[model samples]
Target: MAATIPIGPYHVALKEPIFLKLEVEGERIKDADIKLGYHHRGIEYLAMRRTYWQNIFLFERVCGICSDAHTTCYCQTVEDVAGVTPPERALFLRVLVAELERIHSHLLWLGVAMHIIGFDTLFMQIWRDREYVQDLLEIITGNRVNYAYNTIGGVRRDVDEKTIRLVKKYMDTIKNAFDKTVEAILQDPVIEARVKGVGVLTHEEAKRYGVVGPTARASRIASDIRKDDPYAAYDRLDWEMIVFDEGDVLAKTLVRVYEVYESIKMVNESLEKLPPGPIVTEVSRFPPGEAFGRVEAPRGELVYYIKSNGTNVPERVKVRTPSFMNIASVKPMLLEETIADAPLIFASVDPCVACTERVIIVDSRTNEKKIMTFNEFMIRYGRKRK
Candidate 1:
C-alpha cells in the first residue's frame, strides 16, 4: 500500500512561483494536486476596461516568454471583429516574427530543463547560445520579452535589407548551435537516462486530456493549430508537422529540438519568400461582435475568445492557454509514477504557469458564484480535466 505526500503550493526548486501539490506514495506519485491562481492577473476582466488598441499591448504582457503568441491571438480576434485581412507582406512578416519567438522560447526552455536536471554546464552553454536569438529579436523588435511588435491589422516594424541580412546570419548561427545541442542530448547517455521514457502519455490519453504542442505531438497527436487551423502566413507556408509516438520526456524534448530546426527553416523560407509591401495598416475603429482566435504557440494551441459590443473597448476577453489545457494531463500521468520522476513528467507538458490560462463565465438563472481549479472540478465531475 502507498501513503500520500504533498509537495507544493511552495517549493525551493521552482524559479516560477506557481503552487503545485504532489501526492506521493513512497517513491511513486499517487496523484498530483496543482494549486493555481497564484499568477492570475485577471487580464481578461481588465480587457473590458481598455480600448481595443490598448488591449493589444496589455494582452501581450500575459506571458513574457510567449508574448508574440498572445499578441497574435489578440490581433487576430480584433481583425476578425473588424473583418480585415492583413496584406501578404504583413502576414509574412508576422510569420517571421512568430517563428523567431518560437525558437527563442524553446531555447530558453531547453536551458531551463538542463538546469533542472543538474546539467549546469549544458544550461550555461544553451543560454549563452540563446543570446544570439535574443539579440536578433531585440534588433528587429526593439524590446526582447514583450515585443509590443504586433498591432491590429499588421506588424509595427518593417524589415529592411540590412536588417534582413543580419537576421539571416543570426538564424544560421543559432541553427548550427541547435543542431549541436540536439546531438549532445541524443548521444549522451546521461541525458538519455534523464529524459527517455521517464514519463509516458499514450496517444489516446493525450487526446483525452487535450494535450497540445510538443507534449501532444510526443504522444502522436497531430493537433498543431497552425496545421489544423491556418492563420496568417501559415496557410501559405510549406512545412510538415512533427509528431512522435513514444510520448515521454525525451520525446517532448526531441520535438522541441526538431522544432527549433523547423522554425529555422521557417525563418529562412520567410526571408526567401519575403513579399513586397508595407508592414502596417492603420485603422482607428473596429466593428464589434464575437470572434474566436487560435494560434500555434511555442507551447501549443492557444485559444482566445473575444466579445465586442460595437465599442472601442471589448466587452469580454477569454483565454484558454495551451499550458492550461496541457497541464490537465499531469494528474493522470503522475499516477503510479516514481516521485523523483514527477518533475520530468510535469516538464513534459511544457506549461508556463504564469501565462497559462484565464477564464470567466456567468449563469443566466441564479448568477451563482463559482471559482474552482479545473482539475478539482474534473475529478469531482468524474471526467479528466482539460
Candidate 2:
C-alpha cells in the first residue's frame, strides 16, 4: 500500500505557499500532484482599472523577486501598442538594472539552495556577497528590490558617472570572488553526493514540459528568449547561454552559478557601450492594438500580452510566468525518487509560487453571499485529507 504525504502550501522546506501531494511506498515516491492558488491578487483585472502608466507600478508587484522583469516586460508590451521607442541610453540603463537584478536574484537562489542543503555557512556567505549587488542597485535606481527604474517610454532614472564607475567596481568584485565561490560548491563531496544525479530531467522532458531558465538550460535545451528573440539591449550585447547535459540538481546549480558571470559581463559591456540621449519620449495616446512582450528574467522567459482599445486603460492583460511553465515538470521528476530528494528536486527549479498563484470562479445565476476562512473553503471544496 502507498501512503500519501503533503509537503506544502506551507512546510519547512518550502518558503512560499504551494502544496505537493506525494504518494509514496516507504521512502520512494510513486506519484505526485501539485496545487497552487493559495494567494491571488487579481493583477489582470487591476490592470484594466488603472491607466497604462499606473499599471506599470501594479505589474511590478506581481513577483517581488522579479519585479523589475515584470515591469520591464509590461512596459515593453505597452510600448509596442503605443508605438513608442525608448531612447538608446534608456535601453542600456534598463539592461543594466535588469542584469543587476539577475545577480541579486540568482544569489538569493544560491543562498536558499545552500540553506535547503543544510549548509548554513555558505548560505550566509552568499547572501553577504549579494549585498554588494543590492547596494549597486540602490545607488543607481534609488531603491533596492522593486527599483521602479523602468517606465513606459523609457527608464525613470539615469546612471551617473559615479554610479557607472561603482558598477564596474562591483562587477570586478564579483569576478574576483567567482572562482572561489564556485570551487566551494562544486568541489565539496557532500554537495556532489546530494545533487550530482538527483532529479534528472531529460532534454525531451524539458521540451515537453516547456521548462525555461536555468532548469531548461541545465537539461541542455539551450532555449533563451534573449538569444532567440533579442529584447532590450541584448541585441547589442554578446554572451553565451550556459548549458549542461546532466539535467540534475548540480547541473542546475552550475548553470546559474556561471550565469552570474555572464550577467556581470553584459552589465559591464552595456556600460562601456552606453549611449547618451533622452531617457524617455513623449507618449500621446495608445491606439487600439495588441502587443506581446517577452523578457529572459532571472528565472526564465517571462511573457506579457496586452490589448488596447484606443483608451488609457488596457482592454486585457495576461502574464505567462516561467515558474508556471516549470512547476508542472516537478510531477515527472518526482516519480520513483525518494521522499528525501523531493524538496531538493522542487527547489532545483527555483519555483516561484508568487508568480503562479491565481484563482477564478464564475456563477451564472445570481450574486452569492458567503464568506469563509481558507480552511473552511478548503474543506468545502473537498480537499480534506484522509
Candidate 3:
C-alpha cells in the first residue's frame, strides 16, 4: 500500500516554506506534488504603482539573495522603455556586482546543501569563505544583500582603483581556498554515496521541463543566458559556461562550483577593462511601448517585462524569477527516489519560493468563490477617509 507524506509549508528539511506532497510505498516515492504561493509579497503589483526609479529598490527586495539580479533585469527593461544607454564604465560596474552576487549565491547554496546532507563542517567552511564575496559586495554597493546599486539609466556607484585591487586580492583568496575545498568535497565518500546517480534529470527531461541555470547545465544542456542572449557586459567579457552530463545532485554541485571560478574571472576582467566615464545618465521620460529584459541570475534566467504609457509609473510590470522556472523540474527529480534524499534533491536547484509567487485570497464566507486581485484588495482596504 502507498501512503502520502507531506513535507512543509514548514518542515525540518526546508529552508523556506514550500509544501511537498509525496506518495510513498515503503521507502520509495511514487510521485510528488509542490505547493507554492506561501511566501508571495505582491511585488509585481507594487512595481506598477512605483515610478521607474523607485521600482529598482522595490524589485530588489523581491528576493533578498538575488536582489541585484532582480534590480539589474528591472533596470534593463526600464532602460529599454526609456531608450537610455548607461555609460561604458557603468556597464562594467554592473557586471562586476552581478558576478559577485552570483558567487555569494552559489556559495550560500553549497553551505545549505552541505547542512542538508549532514555535512555541517563543510557548511561552516563554505559560509566562512562566502563572507569574502559578501564583504566585497558591501564595499562596492554600500549594502550586503540589497545593494540598490542599479538604476534605469545607469549604475548608482563608481569603482575606484583601491576597489579594483581589493577585488583581485579577494579573488586570489578564493582561488587559494577553492581547490582544496573542491578536493575535499569530491574525495569525500559520504557525498559521493549520497549524491551520485541520485535525482537524475536526463537531458531530454531537462529540455521538456524547461529547467535553467546550473541545474540545466548539469544535465548537459549548455543553456546560459549570458552566452545565448548576451546582456550588460557579458558579451565583451570572456568566460566559459560549465556543463556536466550526469544530471544528478553531484553534477549540480560541480556545475555551481566551477561557475564560481568563472564568475570571479569575469569580475576581474571587467574591473581591469572598466572604462572611465559617468555612471548615471539623464532620461527625460519613458515612451509608450513595451520591452523585455533578462539576466543570467545565480539560480537561472531572471526575466522582466514592462509596459509604459509616457508616465513616471509603469503601465504593467511582470517579473519571471529563475526559481519559478526551476521549481517545476523538481517534481520529476523527486520521483522514484527515497524519502531520505528528498530534501537535498530539492535544495539542489537553490529554490527560492519568496521570489516566485504572490497572494490570491478567495472569499469562502458565502461560498461565492471570488478570487481577489492584489490591486482590488488594496484599494478596498486602503480607501481614504471622506
Provide the global lDDT of candidate 3 against the true structure.
0.90
Preferred candidate (TM-score higher): 1 or 3: 3
Tens-place lDDT per residue, model 3, 1-386, is 99999999999778789999999999899989998868877787777778888888898888899999998899888999899888888888999999999999999999898899999999899999999998999999999999999987889888888988988999999877777789889999998999999999999999998999999999999999999999888899999999999999999999999999999899889988898989988888898999999999999998999999888989888888888889999989999999999999999999999988856565678655455764576678894122
The prediction achieving the highest lDDT against the true structure is 3
lDDT of 2 at 229: 94
Clash count per candidate: 1, 1, 0
Error of 3 at 127 (Å): 0.2
Any residue pairs clashing in model 1, and if so which? Answer: 8-20
Candidate number with greatest TM-score: 3
The lDDT-based order of candidates, best leading, equals: 3, 2, 1
TM-score of each: 0.91, 0.92, 0.94
